[model samples]
Target: MNPFTYARAENAHDAFALGSQPGAKYLGGGTNLVDLMRETIERPVTLVDVTGLSCEIEERAGGGLLVGAAVRNTALASHLAVRTRYPMLARAVSSGASAQIRNMATVAGNTLQRTRCAYFYDDEGSRCNKRNPGQGCDAVDGFNRYHAILGASPGCVATHPSDMCVALAALDAVVHLQNARGERTLPFIDLHRLPEDRPEIETLLEPGELITAIELPPLAFGARSTYRKVRDRSSYAFALVSVAVALELDGDTVKDVRMALGGVAHKPWRAWKAEEALRGKPATAESFRAAAEAELAHAQPLRGNAFKVELAKRTLTAVLAELKEVKV
Candidate 1:
């Protein structure tokens, strides 16, 4: 790791001031950033610790929830409001990493975590566009079984690796951000940028912007939501394909729905097409399968990851079916 100066921010004002320095990065749980620093993928001269900022989970006025960016993953997942009102978010958080890592990982850190493409990490042996822009992406033609199938370009085929983000996308969560300029809010789905020619740039965040909190809008049927992940292993494994869905049904007809897909895209892919197709339609296996097809219609899979198309379809169908049977 490179030699760096460390400073702990007592509040957001301190964080913004300290983080505005050259080559400075905001430190949350240091779960992903620290590892990237060790790999020399990220070399910051200053580390501004923001874990002491806002860690509260407050209920929104109407029915939503306001989650502090510094809130730990375990705390967010286990919170009564999250588990009961937004079960998918809880399940997604629980499905990530392990208990120890979850205990240390923060909400903002998890949301901003980088992709886990093997080629992107093998700095010495592989050429990754994400690691060094225009150097070339080895994962495109190399071991791409776990790479992206959606919103990927010729320069990159990496998938975002945050399970929590998948649920956040489905829930239409908004991210609260602050920087030297001022404060702003961005829709969670719009936070991450699609990897185009400039694969190095990930999120749409302005330079030195710190995530303040995450705001989840109200969903009356949020209690019926669920998250499902399929991976190579049962634990401590990233999703091969994951689904997060919140559905509302009127008898056998779909009244409303929100869904997002992970492990198949550059970012959490909000299944707008699938949701559009499912809404006002009969809630059945056929409808669910058709909706999945509609969502994956534009998916362009790589050589080794083509199976993801079918896997995603099947998984979406299964999750929708499972949620349909829920009494709530």
Candidate 2:
């Protein structure tokens, strides 16, 4: 790790001021940042510790929930309200990393995690566009079995590696941010940018901008939601393809649907086209297949990840079928 100055931020104002400095980074749980530092992938000159700030979960007006950015992943997953209402979110968080890491990883840290692409992590290599812009992406031609199949550009083919983010996207969450300029809110869908021309610029956050909390809007079918992940291993493995489905059904017809996919794009892939096709439609296998196919029709798969297209469809179908069977 590089020699760096450390400062503890007293509040959001202090944290943003320190973070806006050149070569400074805000530290929450230090889960992902610490690993990148050791690998020499990230070498900040200063670290502004923000974990001490009041990071508590609060109930918002109108039956929503405001989750502090510094809340631990384990605590957020096991919270009584979260487990009882947004079970898909709880399941998604629990499905990721080991128990110890979850206990130490913060909610905001998980939202801002780097991709698990091997090329991006190879600091010694000179072919990762995400790590070195305009250097060219080695994963495009190299072993890219886990690379993205949707919303990818020639500059980068990597995918975001957060299971929690997929659920948040489906729940229509809003991200609250604070910076030296002031405060602002962004929809969770807009938080992550596509790896289009600038793969290095991952999130919409400007320099020194700190995520204060995330607000999940009142949901109708959260209890009927489900998350299904497909990976090489059953435990402690990154997703090959994952689906989060939060559906509200009216008898046999779909009343409303929120869906998002992981491991298939540069950000949490919201299946808005799929949702449009399913809303007011019968909740049957044929309807599910058509909706899934509609969203996947835009996928541009590389040589190694063509199988993801079919896998994603089946995962969507399975999740919707199970969610439909649950008594509302």
Candidate 3:
């Protein structure tokens, strides 16, 4: 870790002011940032503590919820409202990290967490474009079973490792952010950038911008939603392929659907094409398979990770099949 100055921010203005300084970084739960610091992957000189600021969940006007950035992952997962209304989110949140870590991890920190790419963390040898732009990527030809299959560029093949973010993308959640200038909102899907030419730029956030809260619009259909993660081991392991499905059924037909995939792309992979294929179609195993296949058709999996394409397809099918049982 680097020698750093620490300041506890009192408000958004204070946080923005403190964060705008050179080599400054906002401190949330310190679950991700702290680890990166110790690894020497991140070396911020100034740490502005924002954990004590705006740490409450607020109910929106239309049955929606505004989750504060500082809200702990455990609190969000176990909150009565989240469990009842956005069960997929609750499930996703609980799927990540451990009880102790979740108790300390914040919602904003989870979204901003870096990729768990091995090369990105190998400070000694590997060349990671995410860690050093124009350095060239080593994961492209390395042991990359966990590398990305979709939205991967030649510059990088890393995947976003946030289970909560996958659910947020499916729910059409909006990210609220603030800076010294003012405030702005972005769709959750747009918040993360693809590992394109500029793999170093992970998100769309401005330098001093801080996430305020995430607003989840009311989704009555989310009552039937669920999140499923498949990994090497059950607990404390990152998803190899995960699916979040929220379906609205009209008898035996699909009325509406929102599907997002994780551990397969630079960002939460929203299966918009698959959702389009399933809507108004008979909610059957064949339809699910076909929908999943339609989305995977565009996936450009690397040599070592081509199996992820089929795994993602099967996972998506199973999630939709499970959702089919939920009474509309």
Candidate 4:
């Protein structure tokens, strides 16, 4: 919203070149970045529009999908291949922002979105180290119900807010980035960074890195996956405790499952421990309840977020039970 120079990039090379500038930033869909600019949370003197760099969905050799970073959420979700093979991801994309937003929000842009920390948006020099290094964090002890419970430190308590991230983690998607180092593929789980000592750096992307595409492996269970989100309202709200699960059950026994959580951690909290507990186990309510308990054993709830422990467990149990009833 401020005075920022804008240029439409022609290709990946051009995009990265512009983004590598000292005070320049890449513009994908302008969904999150524009909003942050409006609040002065992000103040870039130059904006390089990368949406013109033709990036779309393509089929990979492994029967998987290669989603270009500039591809809009609506296009990705509505694609026949994505709808048939990755319904959970489709549903997650649909659940985001709104129809108008989804039409403009790109896949990679949404994945790289910053936290919804209110303190970060305060332009009046509030106590937020993420906004200003060494400024201190005030949300650590104030209105932190939506803050993180995992991968949190005294320095910061912000939570990652992306439903598609949970689904991507559950499905083991890989992000392909083009930067000064050429091209590299990183695991989706490894993309986000914890607010350990530096809350300002939220991701592993270096300066000038352009997210090219996200590649999902040929997962047998993606079609049967489901994402369960619990918020204060039924629609248009962030999750209180959400679960994205892809389950394959054999009658009363579990075959395989992939689980991830949102609204609880610095990144998509992949529940590998919970998956281990449920695999090959009896697909019963008791077994699911036990798995839920086992998964939440290490959660360190804060002053106002103890309810998340119960909410997460119940949600996991419900998802497992529901999967069992309609086993793939």
Q: Can you write out model 4's per-residue Cα lDDT over 1-328, one digit (the tens) per residue?
A: 6798998898888888888988898898998999999997888999999897656788998789899889998998899988888887888888777789889988988998888877777769569988888889988877788887777888888888888888999999999998897889999999998889999998998887888899989988677888888888877777788898888876768899999989998888999889999999998898888888888888887887889999999999998778666634
Q: Cα lDDT of model 1 overall?
A: 0.95
Q: How many clashes in each candidate?
A: 0, 0, 0, 0
Tens digits of per-residue lDDT, candidate 3, 1-328, equal: 6799999998887888899889999999999999999999999999999987777888999899999989999999999999988899999999999999999999999999999999999989999999999999999999889989988999999999999999999999999999767999999999999977999999999997999899999998888999999999989999999999999988899999999999999999999999999999999999999999999998898889899999999999999999889765
TM-score, model 4 to reference = 0.96
User: CA RMSD for every model?
Assistant: 0.7, 0.8, 0.8, 1.4
Worst 10 residues of 4 by lDDT: 319-328
Error of 3 at 215 (Å): 0.5
Error of 2 at 206 (Å): 1.2
Clashing pairs in 1: none
Better of 2 and 4 by lDDT: 2
> What's the CA RMSD of model 1 in angstroms?
0.7
lDDT of each: 0.95, 0.93, 0.93, 0.86
Native-referenced Cα lDDT, model 2: 0.93
Off by over 4 Å in 3: none
- The full ranking of all candidates by lDDT, starting with the best, is 1, 3, 2, 4
Model 4, runs deviating above 4 Å = none
Indicate the residue-level lDDT of 163 in model 4. 84
**209-324: candidate 2 lDDT, tens digit per residue:** 99989998989678899888899999999999999999998889999999999999999999999999999999999999999999999999999999999999999999999998
